[model samples]
Target: MLIGIPKEIKNHEYRVGMVPASVRELIENNHEVIIETNAGIGIGFSDQDYIAAGASIEDTAAAIFAKADMIVKVKEPLAVERAMLRQGQILFTYLHLAPDLPQTLDLIDSKAICIAYETVIDTQGRLPLLAPMSEVAGRMAIQAGAQTLEKSNQGSGMLLGGVPGVAPAKVVIIGGGMVGNNAAQMAVGLGADVTILDRNIDTLRSLNIQFGSKVKVIYSTLDVLEAEVLAADLVIGAVLIPGAAAPKLVTRDHISKMKPGSAIVDVAIDQGGCFETSHATTHQDPTYIVDEVVHYCVANMPGAVAKTSTFALNNATLPYIIKLANLGYKKALENDQGLLEGLNVINGKLTCKSVAEAHNLPYVTAKTALAI
Candidate 1:
């Protein structure tokens, strides 16, 4: 199989789909790999690096798009790259289609085998592919929110872990999943007053056990959420609903009533956002003021740490890529129930029920779509 890796074109996105070592693994499997020239350059892997790993480099993304059997990418293809998609070409990437209607429509028209990394499941029913990035984004949320708290950024100017003589900042994280858990870990390590809220009693219990007296874990309810946001110096929106749009837990009214200079990091911005006022921002301009509350809602937060993110993501995705290349997508998807969950679109049909319900479109089971 011929696999292609295109340089990520999203704003401030520097991670490559496949690194040199990842390419070498595919090459050893007798697969041909092509990458756009300098695709890994931002992550410090030069074109020569990929070449040395047995990958052919193309001068333009157009050429890579024109030929490869499968297009491995780091982010959802932008408009231009989406236009280049060929029917039946395997697109294995993070396609957060639930919130982007135009992308969903374009993908349907392309009739490609769209395997979304974000929706892929593991044997334990966990999102294995999405977890790595979630971990990165979650940890970064604290870093970004702390920066946003500086007076220079129009934030409330509160230090995350205040001086010994001063009280530590109050950090409130919504959701107790991977993102929330990681965020809480960072915040607690910084000696901040950290609190995590979730609807799942078991998750809350687990978090309580994990943090003990160092952090607070609470049951999530409307009143509890409102109270926490009003008191928090930094609020991290980390909730997720698998492939569906994130629920808007923090309303506009919640933003207005928050103390002036307070900051919010909406880590769930990729799946729409849990905060009503959150809009996707780029690293170049990563914040906006909403009712005196600073909003940090970069959709690709992990992209800010390109090298770490690329390597971590590659570690998780490479085995699946190998399977698709060696066994062919159909056989691979058929053999792995978890991989079949990754199928969003194939042969012009919507195979992901979440995406179909998001757009109120017709849906078919992956098996039905493939006539397996």
Candidate 2:
């Protein structure tokens, strides 16, 4: 199999699909790997580095797209890259398609085998491919929120962790999943008054045990959530619904009532955000004010730390890439039920229920689509 890695074209997305070490692993499996010129440059992996790992470099994304059997990418392919996809070709990457009807339609029209990394599940039912980036984004949410809290940034001039004489800022995190857990870890470490709210009693109990007295775990309900958001100096929206669009837990009314200059970091922005006022922003201009409440909803927060994100992502995805390359998409998906869950589209059929429902389009089960 010939695999291609193209440089990410999303605004300020510096993470690549694979690192040289990942390429070397594919090469060892006797699969040919090609990297577009300077594909890994953003992450500090020079073209020579990929070459050293036995990957041939191509000067044009067009060539890579035209020749490769499978296209490996970090972000979902943009419109132009989507146009380049060939029928029956494999696309292995993060495809947040529920909120993206255009991309879903494009992938459907392309008739490509689109295996979304975000939709992939492990035996434990956790999203393995989306976990690492979630961890990164979770930790960074506090950093981003802290910066947004500065008076100059249109935030209440409050320090996240106050001085000896001052009280610490109140940090409220919605959802006690991976993103929320990591966000709480950072917020608590910075000496903020951290509170986590989730609907899952088990998750709440787990967090209670994990942070003990340092973090407050609350059962999420409408009244409690509203009160917390109103009182918070910084609110981190970390809720997720896997491949579906994120529920808007924080309403515009809530934003209007939030203390002026208070900020929110919507880590769930990639899945259309848990905040009603949230919209995808870029790193170039990440935050926007809504009702005097600052919203830091950068769709790709992990991209801000590209080198770390790239390596972390590669660690989780390389094995899956190798499996697909060696056994082919059909065989690999059939072999692993979790991998099959990653199949969003194949041969023009929409295989992900969440995305199809999001678009009100037809849905096809992966097993039926693949005749498994």
Candidate 3:
């Protein structure tokens, strides 16, 4: 099997799909890996580095896309790249299709086998493939929110960790999943007043035990969420619904009621955001003011830390990539139920229930789509 790595083309996206070490692993497994020129350059891996790992370097993404049996990418393919997809070709990447109707339609028309890394689950029912990036994004949410809280950024002139005799900022995280957990870690480490809200009692209990009074864990309800958001100096929207659009927990009314100059970091922006005012922003322009509240909604937060993100992402995704290349996508997916859960589209049919439901499209189960 020939695996292709194309340079990510999303705005300010610097993470590469495969690193030199990952390519070497594939080579050791007797697989041919072709990488587009400069695919790993953003993360300091030269073409020579890939070559040293026994990967053939192609000069153009077109050639890599056209000739490779499977395409491994860091992010979802952009419009042009999606246009390049061919029927029956394998696309293994983070396809956030629920929020992006156009991309879903394009993938369906291309008739490609689309396996979303974010949707893949482990035996523990954890999102193994999405964990690395989620961890990165979660940690970065605090960093970004703190920066946005600076007076120059039009945020409340409050420090996350106040000095002696000064009060620390209140940080409210709207989920108890990976992103919220990490955000709470950062916020608490910085000496801020941290509160995390979630619907799961078990999750809230686990978080309470983990934090042990350093962070407050609250059961999420409309009244509680609104009160928390209103009181927060910095709010982090960390909600996720696995392959579905993130619920809009923070409505426009809530934004309007937020304290003047307070900031919101919507880490769930990739899944359409849990904040009503959230819109995807780029690193170059990461914040905007809405209802006097700063909104930080960079969809690819992990991309800002390209090297760490690429290596971490590779650690999680390489095993699955190897399995796909070694046994072919069908056999690999058939062997792993978790991997089959990653299948969103195959042979022009939408295989993910959430994605199909999101766009009112016809749904096909992964087993039916694969004819297993």
Whole-model lDDT per candidate: 0.95, 0.95, 0.95
- What's the lDDT of the predicted structure labeled candidate 1? 0.95
Q: What is the alpha-carbon lDDT of model 3 when measured against the actual structure? A: 0.95
Count: clashes, candidate 1:
1
Model 1 weakest 10-residue run by lDDT: 363-372
On the 0 to 100 scale, the lDDT of residue 37 in model 1 is 92
What digit string (tens of lDDT, one per residue) describes model 1 on residues 299-359?
Answer: 9999999999999999999999999999999999999999999999998888888888889
**Candidate 1: segments with Cα more than 4 A from true spot:** none
Question: After superposition on all CA atoms, what RMSD does each candidate show versus the true structure?
Answer: 0.7, 0.7, 0.7
lDDT of 2 by residue, 1-372 (tens): 999999899999999999999999999999999999999989798999999999999999999999999999999889999999989899999999999999999999999999999999999999999999999999999999999999999999999999899999999999999999999999999999999999999999999999999999999999999999999999999999989999999999999999999999999998999999999999999999999999999998999999999999999999999999999999999999999999999999999999988899998899999982
Clashing pairs in 2: 156-261
Tell me the TM-score of each prediction against the true structure. 0.99, 0.99, 0.99
Off-target runs (Cα >4 Å) in candidate 3 are none
